[model samples]
Target: MAEQSSPDWMALARRGRRHRMIFLGTITVFLTLVSLPVVMPYLWLLTMSVTTLGSAAVMQVFWRAAGLVAVLYLALIVLPPLMPERFRTWVPAMAAAAAVILTTLFILPLTTLNNFRFLWNPDVMAAQQGRSSTIGELPSIWSAMGNSFALAGTQTALILITATPAAYALSRLAFRGRETLSRGILLLHAFPVMALTVAIFIQSYWMGLLNSILGVVLVLTTLELPFAILILKTFFDAVPWDIEMSAVTDGASRWQAFRLVVLPQVSGGLIAVGTFTFLRGWEEYVYVTTLLIDNSHMVMSLYLFWVSQDAMGADPNLIAATGVIYLLPVVALYVFAQKYLTQISFGGIKG
Candidate 1:
């Protein structure tokens, strides 16, 4: 019997046309949803800054940040169309990095003209003109950044060590009540993380850890455990049981098989997990706010949160500038992990 297969280009093209319309509609909706988070805050910030100075005055900090990102995006968009395909990707990334360095180290300090200073210096006015709003403090922002990096580094190391064994057990070995344990862990998210931090605060106070790094690490470790387990377990499950059996057959111990083979297979997943934990720990506000009551223990999120709010009424500009700096390690971690994000697949059938 002869079997007819597939469709001709005309018929295929008709189907493709229908799907293309649906895809375009879906993309429009998805893009709108995705853009809201970025847009709403900036809108509020724009309104706040403009209204503060009355009449019309430029906000230097926002302009500089927007300008830098805009230039990078414009370069990336235009460079590919004009340059050779071979030079497309690497050239844009290198140029963007150089731009970022220059913006931070050189251009940023020059942009800090206060709105009140308009009458003071005619040259500062001529150089910046109506385009000058005082830039935020650089020194305090740098201190916040140093604190952010330190906390992120500490949290990454702790997450890798603890999450690996816990995830391995969940992935590899079935024990009584294992399902119940996993379910409980997932259900923990039902309690608002912020509420849990409040309870942790009370506990930390009683235990005399309220203003210490240990308190911060303990809170982060607990918060990150469930997510780490889920990610690592998925990666470990993708390893074939037959491979482990064969290793056993060749006199490789289970631990040896895991160390040499299994771990290597899932290193990318581990990195992703570590990066996730580090970012959460570094940027988390509720836990740090409740647990760390002193200047010495302040991480960037708490610091920025306070600074932004006027912290019982302080400096709003300091907060805004610090918040931008606060986002760096997280951005860096994502960029690094994205390079090694490979998909592994599994099937019951094995050769």
Candidate 2:
């Protein structure tokens, strides 16, 4: 046979790149189509919160708002890279201010904050409807928001305090039953906490934790411990022993070395664990509803429930507004912890 000519390498490379582009474009389109059903409801919820009811001009406001947002984000993506390094830092703040100003000019008049009046005016429904209602029995939105923060915050703290040390011990120490214990921890996490709701209720009642935020915090912290410990142990295992050894050689105690050197290395895991724990407590409804009998113990989840109850007239816009408010903390936490959360590592460290 004749010697094979060199393959058309450049043509093959071009074809490969073209195929990849087509595949990626197809995937992007498919995902966007799939996501629209899930995402459009939320988009409608936001628009309903801002758009005027019964107005023909509502779509006008939405398009204007969407345009402003699109431009703002486009500027964010395109302008930053073009600026000098020194001035680039200011672009985001300036862009944000521009977006706000554009919003005020284009959309503010068309929208109403009446839906959110419950934030400051507890009797907003009564005022809007000109009638007495069961809303009077419910706590103010502020009080409910405060209770949610307290419960979630306390629960997050408890998990961190307990899980961090437990994870470190399980990761670093050579002890009897360590492997079995590690597996058991994850197994416990897999078991449904909901299955024990009745037990938890009875236990809380016996312990006088029923109807108390403190009790809810403790219960939630306990439920979150297994997963938190497992996640954190992986982070601990990823840390190199040599770093701790160097610290020890420099005369640091084992505890000090672990705290200073190892802890910093696992900061990402700690943040990820804390964020999940906090969100778990924040969104917990079954336990809160089961254990917290009194309206005084209401959380954001229950508050939203009460707002949407037929007793409250189930005003769709108001309910949507409450939903938006309910989503803020979760969104804020993700925005802040996103950097570290992306650093989360699972499984054993490579040798």
On TM-score, the candidate that comes out on top is: 2
Tens digit of lDDT per residue, candidate 2, span 1-351?
999899999999999978976776676568657865876577677877865577765687767766775577456754554456898788888889998898888878788777787787767844533433545567777889999999999999999999999999998999999999999998999998889999999999999999999999988888889989988998898888899999999999999998899998888788888998899999999999999988888999999887777766777888889999999999999999988777666784333
Please provide, for model 1 over 40-151, each residue's C-alpha lDDT reduced to its tens digit, 9 standing for 90 to 100: 5663354333233332323554455556655665466534554667888697778778797967874555444352232344343234322323322222334555666666
**Over 4 Å off in model 2, which ranges?**
1-4, 7-9, 62-109, 125-136, 348-351
TM-score of each model, in listed order: 0.67, 0.85
lDDT of 1: 0.64
Clashing pairs in 2: none
Worst ten-residue run, lDDT, model 1?
342-351
